[model samples]
Target: RDLNEYLFEPSKLVAKVTDIYLNFAEYDQFCSAVSNDGMSYNEQLFPQAIEVLERIRHPRERIDAFLKLGEHIKTIADQHKEDDVIYNDAPEEYIDQISSILMNDPVMLPSSRTILDRSTVIRLLLDNQIDPYTRDPLHMQ
Candidate 1:
Protein backbone atom coordinates (compact mmCIF):
# COMPACT_ATOMS: atom_id res chain seq x y z
CA ARG A 1 0.00 0.00 0.00
CA ASP A 2 1.04 3.57 -0.66
CA LEU A 3 1.51 6.25 2.02
CA ASN A 4 -1.98 7.45 1.35
CA GLU A 5 -3.34 4.18 2.72
CA TYR A 6 -1.68 4.86 6.07
CA LEU A 7 -2.50 8.55 6.11
CA PHE A 8 -5.93 7.84 7.55
CA GLU A 9 -4.93 4.92 9.76
CA PRO A 10 -5.01 7.01 12.96
CA SER A 11 -2.62 4.52 14.46
CA LYS A 12 0.41 5.60 16.47
CA LEU A 13 2.70 5.32 13.42
CA VAL A 14 3.54 8.95 13.74
CA ALA A 15 4.74 8.40 17.28
CA LYS A 16 6.84 5.44 16.22
CA VAL A 17 8.42 7.33 13.37
CA THR A 18 9.21 10.12 15.80
CA ASP A 19 10.82 7.68 18.17
CA ILE A 20 13.11 6.31 15.46
CA TYR A 21 14.04 9.72 14.17
CA LEU A 22 14.68 11.08 17.64
CA ASN A 23 16.67 8.05 18.83
CA PHE A 24 18.66 6.59 16.00
CA ALA A 25 22.14 6.55 14.52
CA GLU A 26 20.94 8.69 11.66
CA TYR A 27 20.36 11.48 14.15
CA ASP A 28 24.10 12.20 14.35
CA GLN A 29 24.35 12.54 10.60
CA PHE A 30 21.31 14.73 10.64
CA CYS A 31 22.81 17.01 13.26
CA SER A 32 26.23 17.20 11.61
CA ALA A 33 24.79 17.73 8.17
CA VAL A 34 22.55 20.46 9.42
CA SER A 35 25.25 22.04 11.54
CA ASN A 36 27.75 22.01 8.68
CA ASP A 37 25.26 23.17 6.09
CA GLY A 38 21.65 24.05 6.65
CA MET A 39 18.08 22.94 6.04
CA SER A 40 18.92 23.13 2.36
CA TYR A 41 21.18 20.09 2.65
CA ASN A 42 18.31 17.64 2.37
CA GLU A 43 15.68 20.19 1.63
CA GLN A 44 12.67 19.48 3.89
CA LEU A 45 13.87 16.05 4.96
CA PHE A 46 15.49 17.26 8.14
CA PRO A 47 12.62 19.45 9.25
CA GLN A 48 10.12 16.77 8.42
CA ALA A 49 12.08 14.22 10.39
CA ILE A 50 12.26 16.57 13.37
CA GLU A 51 8.55 17.20 13.19
CA VAL A 52 7.88 13.47 13.42
CA LEU A 53 10.18 13.14 16.42
CA GLU A 54 8.56 16.03 18.24
CA ARG A 55 5.15 14.51 17.83
CA ILE A 56 6.18 11.80 20.23
CA ARG A 57 4.68 11.98 23.73
CA HIS A 58 8.04 12.46 25.46
CA PRO A 59 10.58 13.52 22.90
CA ARG A 60 13.33 14.15 25.42
CA GLU A 61 12.95 10.60 26.57
CA ARG A 62 14.24 9.59 23.19
CA ILE A 63 16.82 12.37 22.72
CA ASP A 64 18.32 12.11 26.21
CA ALA A 65 17.83 8.42 26.62
CA PHE A 66 20.94 7.84 24.51
CA LEU A 67 23.72 9.86 26.08
CA LYS A 68 26.26 8.53 23.59
CA LEU A 69 24.39 10.17 20.76
CA GLY A 70 24.58 13.51 22.50
CA GLU A 71 28.23 12.91 23.22
CA HIS A 72 28.84 12.16 19.56
CA ILE A 73 26.90 15.20 18.53
CA LYS A 74 28.89 17.40 20.88
CA THR A 75 32.15 15.87 19.76
CA ILE A 76 31.24 16.18 16.13
CA ALA A 77 30.38 19.81 16.62
CA ASP A 78 33.61 20.34 18.47
CA GLN A 79 35.73 18.45 15.96
CA HIS A 80 34.23 20.47 13.17
CA LYS A 81 36.00 23.39 14.88
CA GLU A 82 33.17 25.69 13.94
CA ASP A 83 32.64 26.67 17.55
CA ASP A 84 36.35 27.04 18.19
CA VAL A 85 36.78 29.33 15.17
CA ILE A 86 33.98 31.53 16.34
CA TYR A 87 35.24 31.47 19.92
CA ASN A 88 38.71 32.43 18.78
CA ASP A 89 38.55 34.08 15.36
CA ALA A 90 35.10 35.57 15.38
CA PRO A 91 33.85 38.22 17.79
CA GLU A 92 32.97 37.08 21.31
CA GLU A 93 29.28 37.37 20.56
CA TYR A 94 29.72 35.66 17.21
CA ILE A 95 30.86 32.28 18.52
CA ASP A 96 29.56 31.83 22.03
CA GLN A 97 28.43 28.26 22.55
CA ILE A 98 28.25 25.71 25.32
CA SER A 99 29.74 22.32 24.52
CA SER A 100 27.97 20.68 27.39
CA ILE A 101 24.21 20.70 27.31
CA LEU A 102 24.07 21.55 30.99
CA MET A 103 26.56 22.99 33.44
CA ASN A 104 26.67 19.61 35.16
CA ASP A 105 27.02 17.62 31.99
CA PRO A 106 29.63 14.89 32.22
CA VAL A 107 32.55 16.82 30.73
CA MET A 108 32.60 15.58 27.11
CA LEU A 109 33.57 11.97 27.52
CA PRO A 110 32.30 8.69 28.82
CA SER A 111 34.65 9.12 31.88
CA SER A 112 37.53 10.95 33.60
CA ARG A 113 37.84 14.28 35.46
CA THR A 114 37.10 16.05 32.17
CA ILE A 115 34.10 13.81 31.37
CA LEU A 116 33.87 14.24 27.58
CA ASP A 117 37.01 12.50 26.39
CA ARG A 118 39.34 11.78 29.25
CA SER A 119 41.49 9.43 27.23
CA THR A 120 42.10 12.02 24.55
CA VAL A 121 43.28 14.45 27.20
CA ILE A 122 45.31 11.84 29.05
CA ARG A 123 46.99 10.77 25.86
CA LEU A 124 47.83 14.32 24.81
CA LEU A 125 49.08 15.26 28.23
CA LEU A 126 51.09 12.08 28.53
CA ASP A 127 52.58 12.51 25.09
CA ASN A 128 53.84 15.91 26.10
CA GLN A 129 54.49 14.76 29.67
CA ILE A 130 53.52 18.20 30.88
CA ASP A 131 51.64 19.32 33.91
CA PRO A 132 48.24 20.93 33.62
CA TYR A 133 49.63 24.39 34.38
CA THR A 134 52.60 23.98 32.00
CA ARG A 135 50.79 22.69 28.97
CA ASP A 136 50.72 24.41 25.56
CA PRO A 137 48.80 27.38 26.95
CA LEU A 138 51.76 28.44 29.09
CA HIS A 139 54.11 27.85 26.13
CA MET A 140 55.55 24.90 28.09
CA GLN A 141 57.64 27.32 30.12
Candidate 2:
Protein backbone atom coordinates (compact mmCIF):
# COMPACT_ATOMS: atom_id res chain seq x y z
CA ARG A 1 0.00 0.00 0.00
CA ASP A 2 1.34 3.34 -0.99
CA LEU A 3 1.59 5.77 1.88
CA ASN A 4 0.71 8.56 -0.52
CA GLU A 5 -2.53 6.80 -1.29
CA TYR A 6 -3.52 6.56 2.33
CA LEU A 7 -6.93 7.96 3.10
CA PHE A 8 -5.90 10.77 5.39
CA GLU A 9 -6.86 14.38 5.47
CA PRO A 10 -3.95 16.64 4.64
CA SER A 11 -4.32 18.70 7.79
CA LYS A 12 -4.29 15.62 10.01
CA LEU A 13 -1.31 14.24 8.16
CA VAL A 14 0.49 17.54 8.47
CA ALA A 15 -0.25 17.72 12.20
CA LYS A 16 1.00 14.20 12.78
CA VAL A 17 4.12 14.85 10.75
CA THR A 18 4.66 18.15 12.53
CA ASP A 19 4.45 16.48 15.92
CA ILE A 20 6.83 13.73 14.90
CA TYR A 21 9.29 16.19 13.37
CA LEU A 22 9.03 18.39 16.44
CA ASN A 23 9.64 15.43 18.72
CA PHE A 24 12.47 13.91 16.69
CA ALA A 25 14.61 16.15 14.55
CA GLU A 26 16.41 13.22 12.96
CA TYR A 27 13.24 12.09 11.25
CA ASP A 28 14.33 14.22 8.27
CA GLN A 29 17.60 12.41 7.71
CA PHE A 30 16.05 8.99 7.90
CA CYS A 31 13.08 9.92 5.79
CA SER A 32 15.11 11.64 3.12
CA ALA A 33 16.98 8.43 2.47
CA VAL A 34 13.73 6.59 1.75
CA SER A 35 12.28 9.11 -0.61
CA ASN A 36 12.97 9.39 -4.38
CA ASP A 37 14.31 12.86 -3.98
CA GLY A 38 16.69 13.77 -1.18
CA MET A 39 13.90 15.29 0.80
CA SER A 40 11.57 14.07 3.46
CA TYR A 41 7.79 14.37 3.49
CA ASN A 42 8.25 17.33 5.75
CA GLU A 43 10.41 18.98 3.15
CA GLN A 44 7.72 18.35 0.60
CA LEU A 45 5.23 19.82 3.01
CA PHE A 46 7.23 22.96 3.53
CA PRO A 47 4.64 25.27 2.03
CA GLN A 48 1.88 23.86 4.18
CA ALA A 49 4.12 23.92 7.24
CA ILE A 50 4.89 27.59 6.70
CA GLU A 51 1.20 28.26 6.37
CA VAL A 52 0.55 26.49 9.64
CA LEU A 53 3.31 28.32 11.42
CA GLU A 54 2.24 31.66 10.05
CA ARG A 55 -1.41 31.04 10.87
CA ILE A 56 -0.40 31.00 14.54
CA ARG A 57 -0.81 34.75 15.06
CA HIS A 58 -0.75 35.06 18.83
CA PRO A 59 2.79 36.03 19.75
CA ARG A 60 2.89 34.04 22.98
CA GLU A 61 1.41 30.89 21.50
CA ARG A 62 3.60 31.12 18.43
CA ILE A 63 6.74 31.55 20.50
CA ASP A 64 5.78 28.78 22.88
CA ALA A 65 5.12 26.32 20.08
CA PHE A 66 8.37 27.28 18.37
CA LEU A 67 10.26 26.83 21.64
CA LYS A 68 8.72 23.41 22.12
CA LEU A 69 9.86 22.54 18.61
CA GLY A 70 13.25 24.01 19.35
CA GLU A 71 13.73 21.74 22.33
CA HIS A 72 13.83 18.74 20.02
CA ILE A 73 16.25 20.42 17.61
CA LYS A 74 18.37 21.66 20.50
CA THR A 75 18.67 18.18 21.98
CA ILE A 76 19.84 16.76 18.68
CA ALA A 77 22.14 19.71 18.04
CA ASP A 78 23.63 19.32 21.51
CA GLN A 79 24.49 15.69 20.82
CA HIS A 80 26.21 16.59 17.57
CA LYS A 81 28.09 19.37 19.33
CA GLU A 82 29.25 16.92 21.96
CA ASP A 83 30.41 14.47 19.30
CA ASP A 84 32.34 17.20 17.50
CA VAL A 85 33.53 18.97 20.66
CA ILE A 86 34.03 22.16 18.69
CA TYR A 87 33.52 24.25 21.77
CA ASN A 88 33.17 23.12 25.37
CA ASP A 89 30.76 25.95 26.02
CA ALA A 90 28.83 25.89 29.24
CA PRO A 91 25.08 26.11 29.06
CA GLU A 92 23.81 29.48 30.17
CA GLU A 93 20.37 30.45 31.37
CA TYR A 94 17.95 29.84 28.50
CA ILE A 95 15.81 32.99 28.79
CA ASP A 96 16.56 36.56 29.72
CA GLN A 97 14.39 39.36 31.08
CA ILE A 98 14.79 42.85 29.75
CA SER A 99 12.90 46.09 29.57
CA SER A 100 12.33 46.80 25.93
CA ILE A 101 14.28 50.06 25.74
CA LEU A 102 12.30 50.93 22.63
CA MET A 103 8.86 50.17 23.98
CA ASN A 104 9.68 50.79 27.65
CA ASP A 105 7.73 47.69 28.64
CA PRO A 106 8.80 44.58 30.47
CA VAL A 107 9.38 41.79 28.01
CA MET A 108 10.86 38.33 27.98
CA LEU A 109 13.29 37.10 25.39
CA PRO A 110 13.89 33.40 24.80
CA SER A 111 14.69 32.19 28.32
CA SER A 112 13.01 34.62 30.71
CA ARG A 113 10.26 37.15 31.21
CA THR A 114 9.18 37.47 27.56
CA ILE A 115 8.20 34.63 25.28
CA LEU A 116 9.61 36.02 22.04
CA ASP A 117 12.55 34.07 20.70
CA ARG A 118 15.43 36.31 19.76
CA SER A 119 15.82 34.56 16.44
CA THR A 120 12.16 35.02 15.66
CA VAL A 121 12.33 38.67 16.53
CA ILE A 122 15.37 39.07 14.39
CA ARG A 123 13.77 37.25 11.51
CA LEU A 124 10.66 39.37 11.81
CA LEU A 125 12.80 42.44 11.87
CA LEU A 126 14.65 41.34 8.81
CA ASP A 127 11.48 40.48 6.98
CA ASN A 128 9.40 43.49 7.92
CA GLN A 129 11.64 45.94 9.77
CA ILE A 130 8.90 46.47 12.34
CA ASP A 131 8.06 44.86 15.62
CA PRO A 132 5.11 42.53 15.39
CA TYR A 133 3.65 43.59 18.73
CA THR A 134 4.27 47.28 19.08
CA ARG A 135 4.76 48.10 15.37
CA ASP A 136 7.81 50.08 16.40
CA PRO A 137 11.27 49.94 14.98
CA LEU A 138 12.63 46.44 15.48
CA HIS A 139 16.13 47.19 16.57
CA MET A 140 18.42 44.50 17.87
CA GLN A 141 20.12 45.74 20.98
TM-score of each: 0.25, 0.26
Which regions of candidate 1 are displaced past 4 Å? 1-18, 22-31, 40-63, 66-68, 82-141
Q: What is candidate 1's lDDT per residue for 1-141, written digit by digit as tens?
A: 576766753225645644554555566567675445533433334444445555554456563543344455556756666654644544333221323222222233222223323333444446764334334321111
lDDT of 1: 0.44
Local accuracy of candidate 2 as per-residue lDDT tens digits, 11-115: 555555655554554565633223322243233344456466556432445435545454544455455546436333323233322322122132344222244
Predicted structure 1, TM vs. truth = 0.25
RMSD to native for every prediction?
A: 13.4, 16.3
Cα-based lDDT for every prediction: 0.44, 0.46
